[model samples]
Target: MAAQLSEIEVKGVKIPLIYEKSTLMPAVNLQIVFTHAGSITDEIPGLASLSARIFNEGTKTLGSVEFAKELENRAISLSVGSGNETLVFDMSALKSEYLEGLRLTRELLRQPNFTKEALSKVKTDIKASLLRKESDFDYVAQVELHRRLFEGTPLEYPSMGNRESIEKITLKEVEEFWKKRGVLRRAIVLVGGDVELEEVKKDLLSLLSVLPLGEEGELVRYEAKGDLEVKSVIKNTQQAYIYFGSPFSVKNLREDSYKAKVAAFVLGSSGFGSRMMEEIRVKRGLAYSAYWRISLSKSVNYSLGYLQTKLENEQQAIGVVRELIEEFLQKGITEKELEGAKQFLLGSEPLRNETLSQRLSSAFSAYYRGLPLDFAKEELHKIEALTLEEINAYIKEHQELLQLSFSVVTAPKE
Candidate 1:
């Protein structure tokens, strides 16, 4: 059974909580998700992610190293990371230490000591990481796809920001940025393990009430437009990275969204048996890995496919990908293929929720999207009842998949 999701109001803020008392293990997993607190809402590029990273450094009452020691001493694993739309602080520890976990969460969220010294060190580390990402062909390729696909929009830049932006950001600016955006006006807390509903709710309410209420902010939503074109960056490398996709708009729980998932799987996302992998990599020996993905954020949703090949065969590889997409559009998935894809997607749900952290994350995701606790199962049933005809019709309706914007990173020909 799914956890019972409830909401509590703390000083006019609505905080959502999940109660799951599964004695499956002796551990407790807590996920604290703050909506609209990630890169998607960045006033300054990378500020959302950078500010999130700074939270783990220490609180006003504890230094960075001591803070680290305390969490380690309790065998608690705490992580702070951000996606495009939300900031997440995930904690996993024994059921016996749940109170301490909540206390530490409160400390970090309420009194993060973003000292100049810590800020300087973090900036230096992130700058170095950004520098390294430049040499990563796959990373560069993925980022470039977003850059071109979402050009002139807020979503275009990488979450880490550019060197110029990071260089200009000051410690004072990050503190202010955090102050403005870090308020948990909508706190979605999920707890899974051996714990009572009332106990967890009380603990979360007290800790979360410390978060001040702030006004909501806006972010630029990206809408893809225009003709079929390939944007290539010339480099002096042997491998070429390519990604192509069309901008797709679908809501979280819409019927059409489920069909979209089936389409994605049949096209390329489904591993070695997928269309892109079979035709591009296995049949023709064109690329090493071929895959497609559908990314849905609160503001924007799109479907993209990626492959990497030798620089010599980059254009050929791109052409092949376009051809396969056209064929799939003209001739949608076969009955066998449809069933196989459905099984793969459905069966994969277990692995997705196999761990406590995974369950917490999924619950957080569901809550973030205003979905019910059993959304994954709900979608699985939807997928089970879908027909090939309906799926194909949806694909035909969105035939602009042929107009995928290709972003390629490869060396210029001699």
Candidate 2:
């Protein structure tokens, strides 16, 4: 059975909690959504990610060792993470010690020390990561593609921030950013597993009722603005990495967005026999692999995809991929393809919702986007009811994808 979910407000902050009973099991999981703290709102490139990474390192009330001991003694696991547009605090514990686990997670978030020592270590780690990224063509192609498409915006840079940016961001800046971003504003807390709704609600209110309602920070929502042009970073490498994309905008939970998803699968995201793979790999044998997919979110909308091939044939490989996209856009999709894609999605739903963690993540995303907790399930219904004509029409009308953009990291001309 699906977990029972309820919505409640604590001190005017709406939160969602999912309840599932396991009489034999004694664990509960929590996924706290920190919406405004995502990297999109970062004043510096990687401040949000770095701050989130070190958030659980220690607190003013208790040092790192003590915090570790608290969790260890209770058999709890805690993790802090941030992506392009969201920060999350995830914790799990035996039901017997769940309250203590919650208390410690709350303390770590509410009163981090931001010690110079902790900051130094984290900076070193981030720097090492950035250095490693510099040598990776895959990372280079991905970052450069975003830079080309999202220039002059926060999304233009990497979520981890670049070396110079992360190095220059001071402890003071991180703390200030945290003070403003890490609050009740645009926050949705989701918990699922072996617990009751009321007890979790009561405990959460006690833990965070007094948090300052911080500002909802801003970013210019991403749009497709670039032209069909290839931006290249000439690296001394054996293979050329290529990414093709165009501006794509469809809000979360929309009926058409579901159609767009099916369209994407039929066009490129589906493996092997899909259009991109069939043309660029199987038929021509130009590259070992090629794939495509739509990248959508509340903040930005775009199609992003990648393939790698021998440097000498980089332009040829890119040409074939573009032709595939152009043809797919013009021809739309067949009834057979649409039906297959729908079944692929519908069959995959159970696998996705098999655990409390996955359901909590989905519910949190919906709630973060100001949709009801049940929006994901409803959207699937939309997908199921979609007709071939409807999705094909969606593809036909969106010819703007023809003016797609490209970014390549390739070996320099000999």
Evaluate all candidate structures by whole-model CA lDDT and list the values in order.
0.80, 0.79
**Residue 310 displacement (Å), model 1:** 1.9
Model 1: per-residue Cα lDDT at residue 73: 95
lDDT of 2 by residue, 1-414 (tens): 455567667667665555555444678887777676788888889889999878868787687788888788888999889988888888899988888888887787778869888888889999998898899999999888888788888888999999899889888998897788777765667776677777877888866664677776664576766677988999889999998778875634465567777888888888985888888888888888888888767787788889999888888998898788788878887888888888898888768877777776676666656666667788789899998778877887777777778889987686
Candidate 2 clash pair list: 224-247
lDDT of 2: 0.79
Of candidate 2, the 10-residue stretch with the lowest lDDT total is 15-24
Per-model TM values vs. the true structure: 0.95, 0.94
**Alpha-carbon lDDT of model 1:** 0.80
